[model samples]
Target: MLYQEKHRPQLHFTPKENWINDPNGLVYYEGEYHLFYQRNPHSNDHADMHWGHATSTDLYHWEEHGIALAPDELGTIFSGSAVVDKNNTSGLFESASGGLVAIFTHDGESQQQSIAYSEDKGRTWIKYEGNPVIPNTKIKDFRDPKVSWHEDSKKWVMALACGDHIQFYNSPNLIDWTYLSSFGKEYPSHIGVWECPDLLYLPVEGSSKKEWVLIVSINADGPNGGSAVYYFTGSFDGKVFHPNEKPEDALKWADAGKDFYAAVSWDNTEDTYWIGWMSNWQYAGVMPVSPWRSAMSLARKISLYEKDGNLLLKQTPVIADNRKEAASYQDVTIQPDTAESYAISDTAQIDLRISEASSSTKWGVKFVTDQEEVFQLAIDTQENTYTFYRTEGMIDFSEEFPEEIKGTLNGLDVQNLTAIVDRSSVELFLNNGLTVSTNLIYPQGTVTQLEVFAVNDVLQIDNVSWTQLKSIWN
Candidate 1:
């Protein structure tokens, strides 16, 4: 298989090649952050899904490890969570073998939840001889177990993806689990089917409001395939999840992107950080001639804020911890009917803040080519919005192609727009990553020129920075 590496966001890890889906077993262990993903190691296709392991000291530079877990007689090593057993409460590890324990779904063709044990610092794992530690209970689609230590009750709590609901369970030693209750089903609009559920406590800033967020990914049939993260803000009462409202009243999407799915968080750290597979079920396994078919969004730092009587989750780029490489470009004043162009090197990240003087909205930045091809990010002053439009590149979709597909854009609010362009990908972070559009652009060569223009009226460009990124995978 061809392993073409690209310079991605700082501290956010991605695979060198092949398909990567679902952020599995994300946890901080032994002074390092370990992220395991669903990877098809032998090929770039989506078959033979196995768990590929990688660890990082600061969530930036990653060191690859041997395959963490593979499909045993089981169907596939599906999604799950991991935690550090500080007090050896799981009993899977001894005092001498003090490190971590991973609890994941062993989809044994029958598609049931099974447990495995790892004593050697999460390297090699042995299936719990008492396979299917949690009985299927005949739930049609029970998978993606997220386990956390419930300090309130002082016991282990886990959430499972049951069709249209999240089934709660409790375990004392991480081996035996008892069914608690189901969380969603009364409210039809809450979510159709809750896949990949994460329940955690996040400390609200400047307050003692330790809010519990129950995040679930929904797959609704349609163009979007209904992949989204809906969260309920409340307090967990150990034995049960008593939302302030009914289950239907607690659903809110974490992101408004077309590609975010199967997101899971690590419970080992204090920070509310999460990563999601950045592909959709509608387009999964359908990329053309791609050596790798999928990727995860840069790990996002999540926070809860009360807006308009509702708790809104704000997601920020977690790579800010390693942004020293970004440098400010020369400030350029924009004049009506005047456009400025800058020649870029191999790989670059450009950040710009647009301020409108009057009211005309047609301002934008264009990635220009000598052959007259252009990719544009345009602002609509009248609509108070911005859009990312692509007019070039070969995207061979099996179905009819649009002459131009507006990948993703957001309404202009307080936050500015940031664009990270590598050799093969263009990730546009709109409204400070509240919304994002990630697209693959297989440019034949280096993109050397970038132009900014005020399409209609005079616009003030506050700051622009272009930083050449160093490739770590090479």
Candidate 2:
């Protein structure tokens, strides 16, 4: 009865009650993937922050495990990272087998870094007596520490967001941290105070070498509007990060949509998987969802690839083995000014591939309800861009909700495309995940159909399939 609310997401993760934002302490340990988030247990609006916990063997179905970290004398638990301390590097475990160690921010008098250990697989936590391992040095916007084990120098690394730049530190035991270096003071794109900084090594698609990636989330100024993620690729010596490309050369955005923010990856996983709070700060508090005010974007498996001599990031959704196919089509052709329609459920995954397309082709897909409310995605071949429009539905709750979300195709040879559609969200992955867009919709009527229209040029589609996704919380 809890998740049966009108606009609850079936394919995404949402708290049963209260408000959640900025996923924290993401890690994979033993046989389960842990998702800890910033939660306000008392109300549907953000306040009284705590770290809420959940776990899943498969990324799709999750079991809530209640709160893991609460506000202590120092401060409220804020965004951070978790790791499996194998080899007992922190000397917290009695035996050689290390437990889970969380390095997070304590937002009290001034924001500072702290640590906690989970010996029972994150069920219970013990805050280190030595709180604020890395004390704040009077930085106004100091928070969100992302920590990981750096092997080359054989030291644990901490990437902390400090005002307009990211500060680096190293620790041998996750407790005593030493200052290493700082980056982003010369960075051209200082839109707002940086929050949620993550540093990791990502494997290049065609090469055996791995490159270091630093992700920074900024508030109030994004590619679209407010709260977006941007990343820089380069090399990280155990101490400092040197970008292969200058930060001022061109700013690379991780997600071009309005919703994706505070995206961080899970530690101790074979492949890097990421999740983000799927709401923009511009209109987050004013969203039309009840009971729970926020939901996360679908978990994206990320990797790096080279395109047109530029290294780019690709995000592919992890496919669940439990989805059931509802419909399939092959080699369907739509002439100019023609339209096709199909019945769909409230929660379904739509997979489509473009088999034949021309330079002048313009097409769009409309998710429609019987009440004539529509959310649309339009593709323009001439402009080499796609735009999302949600003007016809229940968008009056926030004036910022009706803005068009657009993304460039980068002259990509368009091929496979996918959309994960749920009761109140649509996540579109285009060109095999080269570009991803996420948006939240609150329609008065239930979405029951999908319509495709060719605005001008004829198009040939292939391997089209629709699969329904079961709700994790139902």
Candidate 3:
């Protein structure tokens, strides 16, 4: 059934056959969110890139539309962001200015930023004849336009991913863009080529204190292995960014997961929502099957909180409204002394809280198998931290040790963990949804089991619930 296999990690709505990657033009317009992506319309491989379009009332159930934009003599419609033009003022949408504006990279002979307008709310798009609004400045790998209207500046600002640094541009209208200064030059060692840049202002812990964040996905270097999102926390003073002191002080990865990449945020939304391509570069192009490739992480609502003087980004499921079928298992606890197992069908979400721990105890839950193959999320009470380890399974981990993939430990006194497991991915939220790690696992069979165990101390399972998820698209 897996055909035209693509490179990105996908959630529920994968077509039976096609190629998909790098979520583009993510915009909330006309009471629905529109998602465009990089796809090869004619075949299952990467060749002629086109913009594949889909829309959803909520982030979950998506309605696929025709190819939104294709390669012209001008170039292929590369990655970009979209905006809703409330007033029919921008001539880009001639008949109706109150439609949508798409700013993307046109990669013909060279890479340049281009603008396109949609009249019927993104159903159709017309490229601006006076194209290449931002000419290629000899920076070979320049693309992925993330544009937003800055209310304070009364203009549109763009964060374009340039090699090593993110280039900023200012525009009075959507058409004309002027190059501004670049950030991250001083911290060249900290990042590689920055791609898929997103800049937004968000409140800290529901407080009035708001800070602007510039998020860039680094393609060449990451904490895990491949690409990762690095953020800068600072204030934008109309023209340039005044960043914080240390790069790591302000820089942060979007997710502690293996599969997250090229994440972009929707524009002009009160609630901060974003989506990411969910496959790693290491595993791209080597998937088991083909015809259809790539997937998106479920849209996530983002928030910021500070713990131990470090800024952490929290992502929650934003597709709750589109959840058509949900089955819940409530208040199930296990004692620390023994190992217990429970059966899970296809896809399930579970929450666990482990209490009564000492310095020399281990507690965790295993998935997908009773022996040889299972994904494990555990806490070493002795180490006073949490760990995520996987045994023999769909992943061929014959060389590396099991503990190599161990994630950040929430310190001693860590008690709660919430986890969501679909067919091929696992997201673990530890210490009351504070620290998290996302991993991708291809389980061997359909009949999966949830197993839990503890070493020394009497492990107490405070609350455990597993909910079955129904298919979103038929």
lDDT of each: 0.68, 0.87, 0.72
For model 1, residues 1-474, the per-residue Cα lDDT tens digits are 124443232223567666788888888877877888888888877778788988877665678787888887767888888877777776766674455767777766456777776777678887777777786676778888999899867888999888878888998878888888888776555335668899978766556787888887887731233456667877778766776657444345565445578888877787878888866665567755355567676677877655455555667655433333555754467766678887764456788865544333567788765455567777664665556554365446523221233322323352467777655455667666655555445444456778878767666766777766655444
Q: How accurate is candidate 1 locally (lDDT)?
A: 0.68
Flag regions of model 2 displaced more than 4 Å. Answer: 357-360
Misplaced by over 4 Å in model 3 are 1-11, 95-97, 188-191, 248-251, 321-337, 355-361, 370-372, 381-386, 396-404, 409-415, 431-433
Descending-lDDT candidate ranking: 2, 3, 1
Which is the better candidate, 1 or 2, if ranked by TM-score?
2
Candidate 2, 206-277: lDDT as tens digits? 889778899999997787788889889898989989987774576688888888999999999989999999
Report the CA-based lDDT of candidate 2 relative to the real structure.
0.87
TM-score of every prediction relative to native: 0.85, 0.97, 0.89
Q: Write the per-residue lDDT of candidate 3 for residues 350-450, one digit (tens) a residue.
A: 66665453232677777755444767777775575566675455565323222335545544356666676666677777665556666666656543677
Using TM-score as the measure, which candidate wins? 2
The Cα error of candidate 2 at residue 135, in Å, is 0.7
